[model samples]
Target: MVLPISRFWYKFSLFLACLLVFWAGFYPEWVEKYYAQAFYPHWSRTLRFLLGNIPFSLGDLVYGLALLLLFWAIGRMGRDWGRMGFRSASWLWLGKILHALLWVYLLFSLCWGLLYVRPSLGTRWQLKPVAYQKEDIRRLTLSLLDSTRKYRQRLGTEAVWRPCRDSLVPWTLSAYAPLALAQRTPALDQASLKPSLFGAVGDWVGYTGYFNPFTGEGQYRADLPFVLQPFVALHETAHQLGYAPEDEASWVAYTAALNHPSDRVRYSAHLELLGYALAEEFLLYGQEGSFAAFDSIAKENKARMDPGVRADRKRIRDFFLSRQNQVSPAMNALYDQYLKLNRQEKGLRSYHAVLSWALAHQN
Candidate 1:
């Protein structure tokens, strides 16, 4: 049912899509002006308006149905291979599979994937890129470390907040208020943000939050520590705002959370960015001597953290480590490939590029 095209038409459509993708690569400004700024806002707004009040994640439901359909197709093709012979079945199903993929890619691109080709967030904002050194990263790490401790101190020991959707939604929206006002972009006055239906599975699979581009909804794991939820939610919402790349979403979210009025939200943002800053700083230390020596240096660096910060970080680390399984690495590898295919040159490493943008902004 998905393929309403003849074989010739399917090939033609695929050819057109390839051409469009090639054109998009060369004309990022055009995509930014027409698609990201003009078309995507109206399209995403309509989707949010239609889907926002739903009590559950319609996006998750869509994914579930899609998986079922995939399984059904595989089963049907297997049956066809027995009945119609290998060559005949291959001829039949391969074309169908290609057609299905074409439809999926087209829908994905029209809905959200084309945002991948839009101008970089820095270019969009006209921020001058700074040539940062190891010292800049070290200073940023120290600054973030100090702020994280201060904010964590403010929250005291009672950091566990209930995932009250009512307040959480507004908290994230309000974080974007100043940016929305300044940019005069689409108003995220309403949201289709939800706790992901796949929360438990997501913990093992490793994602705190994601935006469902197909359904125009932002989803976060409700079971995440309160400290992690605010920034995760804001990051997902950044996707809904049409910042497609991981680093772009993170940079936008970090900047927004920094402007947030709540100490908890600001603390959450700084704490996570501190980790990124530290990781970048660690790379500066490089591989000095043996693994044992590097491990010693790592431990020494961590030993400098505030006691409460160390404990909290350990709790967060242990939470994920306990849930991790054999599947996590394979899933992560797949996602890394997915990012690379989407034009993120650093793949998973793109998430850490927020530190570079932050450093640029600082300079």
Candidate 2:
């Protein structure tokens, strides 16, 4: 008796999946560093440039194509399996189980390896304080402007300035390339990270954002006030650029916004760091000056904040402080592990680390 072509194909796919799982688990670093470097960095930007400006609805296009393929596959399977009966059914069930097992094994291997090696990989940079005074803000702003101008000169017209839905595609694609190659998959479904109402309801300041590991999409809720939106947009955009670690994302976004040409964008970046500076001051010095600085900035920011924006921020802050948002011991441990893996010596809590860099340099 001859084996069916479908059975042979399914078995081959299963074998390939198993091989991928083994490779991914044992050699994640090689895969991440080498394979990722080859296509991800350059292809990402090219693909984004090509697809970013397409005007058609991606949802409609994707769903329509998926439905068509699903129906076509079902029809073909039904016709073919009608002749094989129990044998076809058995093969189908077996193939599905093998596929699922392969997926589970791959996921387990990747996560386990990442968790295991995180501590060994370290960061190259450190944060130490420099004097920061109100008088220095103008100088700092000018330095950022110079950096932005230089970067623009280097990149020419292709430089990223404004935030758009497609602006983040390159970053997201690059971040996920390793996983995609490891699993021998085309790409994960990034559409899941698209902004939704559900995400906006939870601890989100009218602008919930996420760096989705599965699809590698950095999604953001775009309805927030302009003051906060630019910074958050840059933060999420950084994640899309393969900066998975939160503090790094914060730093990159801060720099990006600070360098942006617009005054509002610059202010947004400053505010984010200023908030972190205040937090650090409170934790380290515990002086009236620390609180005084925070209060002054808060009052100034508040005077500028739109009423609707203030209400939204208050609602989001309350949600963040609620029981549901409380940090779990396990999560904290994992965070520590992640910091160690990423070479972040200061651990996982310093979104303000960029301030030290900002303070030390003058344009």
Candidate 3:
């Protein structure tokens, strides 16, 4: 007979996942306060410490075994189809998969999904200092351009260009020391960032990195250009630290990376934020001020950018553009829907909202 234990837990886990969904949906306001006060800080630190010092990913092994188990289960059901009876074998294995899925969802929700309901970092920081005008954006852009030039010269060779390929874990950890950690909470300091198991998959999908709520691991795509890795890793780690919304996380990541200990990493952060600032400047001041701001980039800064960094810029552009064909419309639609469901009304454009947040810090 099929084991009764498998069937019971499968159904029970699904029930709990559904219950948590509705409970969170209806009472996110309450969850925000309660989770922040009673659960989040302690829970995040506990998970962080559990595997933070391991140097390798515990989540990776768990995932590898899960994939192997999936294949084994599929084969077992096929092999037993006649002896166990088709109906019985099918239910036993299918129920096992469903049980695993339910438990995964339940774990994910408890660990990270509730963070989506938390108040934005904006509210925490109170960014109402928008009185500064377009001149501020231009000034910041020039400063970032100047900073970017200095770092490019500091990073003289391509030796550092191949960061993720050479194992970026140490540099990633080191980059965190200069952060203006907004909460001032002590537990966040215990958290550490690591590389992801699915780093290859990240390259294929244009994923920079993602915070694995399952194991509280911060992993970045292993194939990103060396310059982009530090800030992207920090951004994903912001999620692990309970900053849920993309824009809010971007703001924190930008703040942290712009002030990072490594000069090269600081320039990389500014470079990323430059694109955002340029976009906003164009919107606010139109082509005139925008081009004028570009003109303001120091001649030495412009001259310092040789062909290699230009190639890196081209490579970064092509990375996303080339991946567009692989990403089906259905996937895009699904992500757009997911963002919308999460109150991201601007959908994917919400990521760009960090520009406004960046400009806010200038004054």
Candidate 4:
């Protein structure tokens, strides 16, 4: 009888959610005006200040409690099996689960999901779609690769810029600030980036970072190599700024990183772009083009990577291949479906869209 009342609200919420999602999808500019400009900026900043001082991720604790509650529910269900009767108790749990699912979707929508309908990074930057030739991509890849070598050498030689576990968060936010200003996105600085408590686990799932819609917190996998931190952090920060599409966020991060002043930060960003460009080239023009782009790096410059830097790069690369058991295929599948339902037709592959947008911006 109590569950019936809860189910009533769930039905109402689902109906309203359907209407809102349809309207948001139909007229995104209205979402920008009625939602983004009117509320999110102030709301996110207040969230940032309240949560920033704690110096650790509150979202992590929330998830931990959620898991505990789930297990508790399961145990209770087992105990109640005879008392409540099988069908009655099973019906109760299923209803509660559906109600919970609806509420999570609603919360996600109001908090950060509307951002999925926002204009793309290319639109914000006024980048015209150019018919990119292989020559264009090759040239851009070559230029970035050269710049990457220079900055890698410059940063590597300076022992002071060496990776410190404690300085990671501060350095990431600092690199993000100028890019925010450059892009005229004031909301970018509203929330500080958070380190994932479950970072070691994240590496196995191939997630470098993610945003918590419920908390408006940006979180990066802390277990990542130092060389890979800035790019991942800034990319997550892009989500905090209300870019919902994964690729668009990556583009924003790359844009900011490319303009970053610090040699270490700039090199990290350039290295990320170099990888993206090379991948696109390989897909579009095959291995010959990728090899050509790779060979463009000066031999002397390639040899200049410090032993520590080389190790950092290797650690980042190996995270995907080395850890299999910890990854959750079911969770990944659900997330993939979520992305497709939102705005990304390519689903998980949308993250790579950063490369083309970034290259176009460079030109």
Instruction: Write model 1 residue lDDT over 168-287, tens digit each, in one string.
Output: 788888998888988933578787789889888795668888899899999888888777888888888899989999988888889888878888789888888988987877786663
The TM-score of candidate 2 is: 0.47
Report clashes for each candidate as comma-separated counts: 0, 5, 0, 0
Which ranges of candidate 4 are over 4 A from the true structure? 1-18, 79-86, 129-135, 157-161, 165-173, 179-183, 187-190, 287-312, 326-331
TM-score of 1: 0.92
What local lDDT does model 2 show for residue 181? 56
Candidate 4 on 81-109: residue-level lDDT in tens? 87899999999889778778777777788
- Using lDDT as the measure, the top candidate is 1
lDDT values for all models: 0.83, 0.49, 0.68, 0.71
In model 2, the worst 10-residue window by lDDT is 113-122
Q: Is candidate 1 or candidate 3 better by TM-score?
A: 1
List all candidate RMSDs to the true structure: 2.9, 11.6, 5.6, 3.9
Query: Residue 21 CA error for candidate 2 (Å)?
Result: 8.5
C-alpha lDDT of residue 35 in model 2: 38
Q: Can you write out model 2's per-residue Cα lDDT over 1-363, one digit (the tens) per residue?
A: 666999889768867866875554466466456434444444444433444444432433444565696688667667657777868766875666566567655543342223222211123223444555544543443443444344434433322224444433443444344444544223532422244334433232223565433233345565443345556666765554545556656765665554354554555565556556545544443344577766665565455444433453465455545634344555666757756655466665645556555675332
Q: After TM-score superposition, what is the CA distance of residue 161 in candidate 3 from its true location, in Å? A: 2.0
Query: What would the TM-scores of all predictions be?
Result: 0.92, 0.47, 0.72, 0.83
Error of 1 at 111 (Å): 0.5
